[model samples]
Target: MIDVILADGFSMLTTTLILEALRFVNLAHRRKAFDWTIKGVQSQSPRASNGFTFSAQRSFEANAEPAELVFLNASYFPDAAASPELLAWLRNA
Candidate 1:
């Protein structure tokens, strides 16, 4: 499984491109070769710097099982106050 960890203000194009490539590969193979889950550091939906808001399937938690692969996508500076929690999760991950 592939996990997409989206940061606030993440690039829509970048996410789309990556997901599209995986989608194409699945089509070519005629099977679900790649499966992804979009997750947020917080429970709230993230809003991009360009004003694009998107929802995540789940929020990162310390006890949650890790995915086979993780994609970290961040396009803008994250709020300083929230960094520690994210950092801790990353460190543990």
Candidate 2:
């Protein structure tokens, strides 16, 4: 299987959430087969509790905004629908 990475922006955007998940996943120390459903989201707004939320991290802080990837939680993404464009990018990246 050709495992090319997809939109780096998307990956970068999710890095924090995913890495945190990975750490928790590893620490669990058991081969669990599932995860709990996210709660408290009602709409498509970034402010929605269970959906993706993005914020710029450049204010006053020394880190450059473009260079900063911020993810506040794991429930940041919505349903995982594999679109054709995403597949293409993953295959070609």
On TM-score, the candidate that comes out on top is: 1
Poorest stretch of ten by lDDT in candidate 2 = 1-10
Off by over 4 Å in 1: 78-82
Cα lDDT tens digits, model 2, 21-92, are 755875686764233222111222223232344342211111212112322232324333244543343344
TM-scores of the candidates in the order shown? 0.81, 0.25
For candidate 2, give the lDDT.
0.32
Clashing pairs in 1: none
Off by over 4 Å in 2: 1-14, 17-52, 56-79
Candidate 1 local lDDT, residue 21: 90
Q: Rate the local accuracy (lDDT) of all candidates.
A: 0.76, 0.32
Give candidate 1's whole-model lDDT: 0.76
